[model samples]
Target: MTLLAGARVFDPETGETTRADVRLDGERIAEVGPGLDGDQRVDCSGGLLIPGLIDCHVHVAFRRPEPLPRSARILEAVPVLRGLLARGITTVRDAWGADAGFKHALAQGWISGPDLLVSLRQLGPTGGLGDTWDPAAGAVDNYGDPSLPDPLFDGPDAARAAVRRMVRAGADWIKVGASGSMRAVRAGVDVRPTDAELAAVVDEAGRCGRDVLAHAHTSAAVVSAARAGARSIEHGTFLEDDAVAALANAWYVPTLSPMSDTEFAGTHRRSLRLAVEAGVRIAAGSDLAPRPHVDLTTELRLLAAVLGDAAALKAATSEAARLLRLDGDRGRIESGLRADLVLLDGTDLDVTDLPGRVRAVWHDGERAGALTSP
Candidate 1:
């Protein structure tokens, strides 16, 4: 048992801020009050305690320069999970990875990382963004190649088959590339899956009691995915006004931070603003991959710059947890939630400057003890 006292607790759910003490028993929050008592105590006299952050979209096995082999990618999960926890992210939803066993390992305490929620390798059509075979490299010469597992389907039947395969492989959710990606697709112009195919994937996912997350970049694709019942739209980069309204009606997640620094931000930012104004739920995700420096704090700061401070904070914490469907268990500092929290150094610090103000972090009621003074 442990007690964290004298901290300004930020409760996103109630929009409440107060000096409080939080008690932790084992891995859960035992109590919260002004002067809680416990077997062990820690002073948080100059800190602010908020819920552990959740990253709705992430690629844990992602590596730079060249894609790593399946075995190597799986092995990197330990360090990646540790890094995320050290940054105060106790939960993460991996958008794509080699397999679900990696996530199961973390959850069963067989691995060293935060609780992982994985959508094993994204599903798409033939010649889609996830189905690249470089014959010249001699790396992906066979089907189910560890280096290049084809994330492709031929049609609706194929799409349904792919969903079953993913479920059988222990996927918690299904990730489908409904449209071509600017960074992942080259030569082939951007194309979206047919309505029939989208419907089939969604239906199959529903039958299996799993949610579908769509990687949609264009307006048409976003609309199609939302209408087809996708749980979240990974990157609604080119959303239109009407599409934003539809997203709000469907309660879709409009993930916008990936394009916050891109050249397309000139147009995408406006769409994002409209989406927010239309009451569509916004979630924070760094899509942190191919670049190691992009952490949750950096993503939150970028979001604040694009949106406002309040929206950014909500996106990073409460909204993101909602998207991941973990709001009941995490995402806020409350009496009956997990004791995963982060302690920042200042109360008067600008929200835009959050990345530099992370003084300490705690996961599962234990201090991270890794962060140094800013």
Candidate 2:
């Protein structure tokens, strides 16, 4: 048993802040109150504790500084995993570029990292975003960048088959492209697949008891994907006011990092504000591919500018967990939930200052001291 004494706890469920001693037993939180009895104690007198952060969209299987062997990539992922653990991100949802192999490895305690939920592979049109190959460019990948494996599909039948194939591969979720992307091989293409194909992917995922996240950028695609029952819209950078209506109950993970420099960044900011005003669910996702020891707080800082402190914090924690279906297990600082928590500098710290304020991290009720970032 361990006692985290005298720290202010932020309740993501109620968006309330209270000071308490959080007691941990085994892997769960045993109690949260002013005076919790425990065998071990840690002084958290003036620090702030919240549920461990969750990155709703990450690409754990993408290329690193250089493409190495599979074993080398796995080795490279070790420190990356450790960094995430030490930084207090206890769970991550790989939108693409990851497989069940990583999940199983992490589960078996072979690699120390956040609990990973993978999408296996991403689905798109033949020459769409996932497949950066351009026939006109003679088999060249014009994008010259790292992307998840592409499972291209043509029709509704093919879309359903692709989803089943991924589900069979132990995918926890599915991602379907609804709009053309920056790396789309085809010129002048905005929407990638037909609406029927997008809906077919959703229908098949539903049949398998899984949810599909739509990689949508345009308002048309966002609206279409929401209507087609997409669980979430990834990078809805161009989503309009009416699109928010369609996504009233669905989640919108605007991967702001990738778009912060593009021409649509302003539009994305406006869209986010509109979405918030229109009752669209906003969850934080960086869409920042792994670069050795990169800061995980990038998106949170960007999100905080649009959302106030508490809303931004919840966006990265409880809101993201709810979207990823892990809220019931670990997103709140409540009893019976996993004791994945973080200790920050102050109760009213700024988001941009979080990297320095991340004084300590806990995973599964214990401090990951050895994995602390230098």
Among residues 3 or more apart in sequence or in different chains, the pairs in candidate 1 whose N, CA or C atoms overlap within 3 Å are: none
lDDT of each: 0.73, 0.80
Q: How far is candidate 2 from the true structure (C-alpha RMSD, Å)?
A: 3.0
Candidate 1 residue-wise lDDT, 230-267, digit = tens = 88887777788757866853444444556666787767
Candidate 1 residue 303 Cα shift, in angstroms, is 1.3
TM-score of candidate 2 to 2 decimals:
0.92
The prediction achieving the highest lDDT against the true structure is 2
Local error of candidate 1 at 224, Å? Answer: 0.4
Q: Tens digit of lDDT per residue, candidate 2, span 83-156?
A: 77777788888877666778888989887888888886778877666665655665544223232333678999
